[model samples]
Target: MARINVSQLKQACVDRGWLDRWLDDPATPVPMPMTPAGGIPVNGRLFHQLVAGLVQKLCVPDASAPLLALRSREQIWALLWDELAAAKVQALVRSQSAEAALHLAEALKAWCQRLAELRANCPNFKSWRSALLTHEFDLKRVAIQVSDGGVVEVSGRPDSVQVDPVHGIVVVDYKLSRGSNGTLDLLQLAIYARMLRLAKPGLNFAGLLEYYEPGLHLVPKTEAQLNAIFEHEVQPVLDRIAGHEKLMSKLKSVQVGHEAVRLSWQPKAEPDLGRDIEKAYNSFKVPVQVMGRVEAPQLVRYLIRPGLGISFAKLRSNAVNLKIQLGLHAEPLVMPGSGHVIFDVVKEKPDTVWWQDEVQRAELTAHASPLALALGVDINNRLILADLCDSNTAHALIGGSSGSGKSELLKSLVATLVKRNRPETLQLTLIDPKLLTFGGIVENAYLTGPILRDIEESLACLHLAVEDMERRYEILLAENHTRLGDRIAQGKTDLPFRVIIFDEFADLINSGREEKKEFERLTKRLSAKGRAAGVHLIIATQRPDKDVVTGQLKANLPMKICLRVTNAVNSQILLDEPGAEHLLGRGDFLSQTGSTPVRGQSLFIPQKEFLELFADKI
Candidate 1:
């Protein structure tokens, strides 16, 4: 049973080239690349070695050992400090810079201080010491064969492994970092336990990771637990490595050409290389430029059998140049060549559901509820519907920059509601200060009144909405109903759900101090108390600043829909997250009803289609 070091397994997993190089010639020794000169200086390696050495020394049975014979915690710390100082001087000599040496010295001292603190403060230190003193564990380096096929070398002896009286073989590995335990480290411990089981059969094993920083951190796992993790987590990795090795073994030749590079493989090999090609292309965005009488470089040919090979060289030079111009590290590029036969590839376009499209009309009219407002189709082409009633989206705050499809989203919302519900079931009051946004739908039967174009009229409409909300509350109280939905359910009233939409809410809020105060007051009132009374607000603003979208207003409007904002600050103001800034605009938006935000592409409806949808009514 050949054993590999745990560090070697980790390195193999991270670097594909490591496995490829090793598999090519098992006997060929490959020296691991060191970090480039002048990289961020770190003494982590020195400290790790020092700690491992100390643990090994302390594990010795001899009572006269210097580390074990230390009387006080200070003496143990002082001894460890001396070892660190010696290692630090060696590192400093290699570094050759006084500044680098100082930084290394300071880092080592901090680590030593932290170790001392852990030894003094941690309650588990005594148990750990007792286990190390009592147990006779295997030396650090061990090897085990993966179930898939290959044998991996895992280095590092467990700090201590005890054949416990009741809990079986307990293996402990010391971690000298200052954070939560990492998964890889725990997996390494599990591997150690696995190796121990194979080496000594009929012994149950348990793995523990002892983190000795900030405080003593202990993670204990039984043999069954470790085995489960190895099967679920480590097995898949080994399988992938085997698959990759097989694929690389079949590679016959790689021809690097001026226009394109071609890859030829052995007979009967079909490697999934599309992902690797796509990853290289995505590193830098380059335009496809065609040479004289030739079409642009595209995925020209792909052969799946008789050893699959792909030829791509068309735009390789162009992509490389673009990467250079952008000051980015260039990845190897392979594109279609000029001599390759060009196929007329028809790229599948996104399905455009226009406002007047019969399909959209059917969707809206099919089991439509006044509470559910359909936003748009998501990236998956599923209709993104938000329930104003159940989702606490009774009042929504929307923010987006110009050309972010803010107006289109508002139009879609209005058109969807109108198409779904009768005028008696839904009513809309639109305030478009810019006048151009909601003018097309002004004549819709769902409109409670004409679109308010002036700021003064918008303010007046908000005041009227407050009055309406107060009236509805009064009616609900008088009728002995808690909510408008309850009243309608009991056949108490036929009051329709009123949705007041304000396009460019910033206009009203930034008009004047007096107007801002009044507008804020009315908006806060409606957003807070209007949900139960069947009144809702959908406010859109291009400017999502602290001044415009105030804390008071934001707190009241729980449902936030943010399109592509100018910066992360605006995104935070809108969705309380830093993602809206990264939105690919012209319909992309992040809608947050609760904590998590859902990204969706708003439905695009051209003005022509919008007018055609309402041609009869208008």
Candidate 2:
């Protein structure tokens, strides 16, 4: 195999956009822009400039240098390792002729295999060793950011976001290190939190800086901290640029200093093994138990790492025919109750636990109509169950991917309600932002108003519903009634509730705080007091983020309808958790009112069925 090429490494850097925003000066052997800043550059000043350039490009607009100073020890080491590894790989690939370069790749591949073996055999050192003499913290590297010159823009990504459902907004930065540097890190957190609020809608943001290593420190965002970062950290960096230009001009320095820029490399030093293991943690932090099922621990280490990406090509090849196998997939009889089969394939042992399967084989088929189960209006009208509505409340959540029959389910429910309840005793208020889900329900002649859409209109609908609720509350107070049920029992005239339904709630919240605040207020009010006022809400969405429908909203809507959510996580988010993800689409749903969920496919009424059903009326 041929030796690696230095020129080609530089070419790789250029092609990959790695050198795009660097602060490299040829006159200085070491580039100041490439080196990490310690307030002012030390060591290789020229290399420091390149590092500064990287910060400028990656940092969010209006970032404070001081606040951006604290980087996680693990991230810092990983960044450096990636840089070194990339340089090594590119050099090896471009050596000699094209054929020779291919041969060199083979050798490099073998070297990585050896490294993998060494890694596997190494003993793991826990970050925390003992109580008194803890060994968790490691000081890795410092992170800095700089402007990405052009039209000013917000530039940065939050690694993770922790939402404070109770107190508006707070941005938390998880870091390592403490004392004076920790103070600087808090300032950085302040700058980021402020920028985040300015960039998005909602309440002004707060900040939290948490350091995991050494000891814990809680840094709350304060105006003074941000000011310190701006005045001390940001201003000094700007001054450096001018200082460098003036000094360079006076000295007439036309060439970079190679010796001045060279890295502090010990001639025969081995790698820093501790930092390497932490850096090898490629996946998100997961508990050891769940880690086995969701992304096996071995896969994360060997399959996805940048250094080991090429090793995966041989993984599938290692799975050739085996003698004896473990687990259900390897069973001789391809069924759950086949029992243990010998490797000889001639003898089988009876597994008596299989009898339990036979008993439940057909009993657990989820055999019931969703509507019949939801309203407790079984075939004979016997009270097989009691619904949330019957217990003097109504609430629901509907989720479906586009064309997954979410709207169809809504229409069917409305039709069922019309058939079961009276127009005079029950009123429906439909809010369809898309203006199509309630197309079939418009002719029912029981709707309180036209479909609620525009923000102002939706808010007004909420206001009107609140007014109706308050009026009922006043009437109840006058009669000394505890609930609408009590008032109706006393022969009240306006005892019918105003059932308000919101469709495409995700889009409504998409406008931000204005709508979200209104919804939050309306939800809190209705959840706490609307049941007495005969005002209940049924909201539906296509997405299942906790931020949208919200945890508070989901909690109040105990009687929920989950229609083919993308996954089990979402199903769990809406309900307790699991069954929704497994829901067969097209109106197949899981409705939970009290405890156990009822799973069944709703009747699919075609257009002809609806047309014939309403043939005499519409």
Candidate 3:
């Protein structure tokens, strides 16, 4: 509570005739109400925290909330005045309509949002009220005139009493909810204006009401509004103190206006994987830019599933000529009427080498932390996978069967990376064809993606990425960047080392067999040209069949890792040898990178630990 001297407030009221008139009027004895500051029933330090939190969040000066310093615990009018706001919130949570209570919780969230707005929009001042620094209304200067011709002291802390630029009074109060009832209403603003005017004689002041729920509303004070305030609002609070209908009405409004409250429950739609997938595929648009002459690059729309498409464009600008010189071959946009033929390779037919380079050169460098826990591993024996560059190599590959630690490894890896870097520095571009491991991490700031639950969108992303690679290569060459680092040094800051990680690559590969020709062409191109162009790939699968693990793919990817396999044959197919079959089945694995297969333990870090690591950074 900000200790405001009660006697001083009484003196101000008496000096200004505010208290004198109240005592003189036999009908209007001022009821001793609780102070606005330190009005919370809470005690000790917890109460202090509550008051400080209010100062931090709500006291912004924008023609409203003009108090330079306001500290109090009283919650006479249920506006979530303090931690006490939680009681009503908790009650709502326990109600049959618990969801509605959750809506009211947004009050706190709104405060936070308001604070953020103040910080971002306003200059850094010592205090929020510094913006419209106003003079205080000395309530203690007024003395109440008793009907018996005697003086009585009046005491009550106004929410905020400030004179506007014109020396007019302005009083502000925040509300969690409001009601339309003629009595005990949000029109309570009128009363504030009237009283302040009464205390200050010829001064003009407006009543300000800042509402949180049922949305924001401001009923400004006019002369008529002021007259109504004194006659209706002020008199009611003073005379009918026992009823407190207005305050109680506000509490009811908060509950009635609760957004979380739902009338009845309805079953959520069952997932239609096939239909959703069709919509995704249909939404794919691959726009081939023939000097924008194609008229349509591709018309892409929202999709229920992830998918792919193709587009093509020509090289007239400096960027295009740049990529052609840097060993990058443009993909053929083969839609007949689409008219997006790119390279002017008239004499020589576009060879498979182009695809070969494109796919094999895809060096997916992922920042990673190895899985420390497996079927039998405990906390003490958790393994640590190596970390990748926050900006560049935060991507990796997994080749193993069902028994492999593919998902487990991914979890550990994600947890570690998040711990190491903030959302701005480290990002997770996930392509989970299995759609399970990273589903939980589909939060506001972490994912760079389609969430990959949709198959067609995933394919579309691949298409876009392929086209983007072509675009980047062109841009890189134009900027004289033979590589991404070179590009950055020369002020070409647009490009980021995109690590395209596809989990359960087996499913992705198998599902796209109908588009096998395109897959082969795209993968080959990704492998051949992607690494230098800053586009990397992490293709994983439980199945290591010949068709799924094509010969072209194995040749291009230089780094590889594997976990336990079901059989020696599966191990051989995945690792090109037999060590994977010997893996201990958890964090234990045979990781092959730079030509040598090393047996090591993965680092085990819990998700909570991981978040705690970079929580401050974000």
Best by TM-score: 1
* Tens-digit lDDT track of model 2 for 1-618: 011122211221211111111112222221112222233111222222323333333244555553233234434334433643345335544643444333333333332332233233334512111100111122121122232221112233332233333322455554433433243454455445545555555746566564433234455665455545544444323232333334345445556556463211112222222232223222222111101111110011111221333232222221121112211122121101011110111012111111112112211112111112222111111112212333212566777666556876666555544444455556778889887776554354457877777777887888878888888889889888866755654556466756788888888777788788887787777766776666777788888767786788877675666767776578778777554654445555555553334443343345445444444432
Give the C-alpha miss distance for residue 284 in model 1, angstroms: 13
- The predictions' CA RMSDs to the true structure, in order, are 16.4, 27.2, 30.9
Clashes of 2: 35
The per-model lDDT (C-alpha) reads: 0.60, 0.43, 0.43
How do the residues 173-243 of candidate 3 rate in per-residue lDDT, one tens digit apiece? Answer: 55554522223333344544554565778877666555656244544455566665454323322322212
Q: Which is better, 1 or 2, measured by TM-score?
A: 1
> Runs in model 3 with CA error above 4 Å?
1-396, 415-427, 489-493, 610-618
Show model 1 residue runs off by greater than 4 Å: 1-351, 356-368, 442-444, 489-494, 612-618
Distance from true location, Cα of 244 in model 1, Å: 42
Top-scoring candidate (lDDT): 1
The clash count of every prediction, one per candidate, is 20, 35, 92
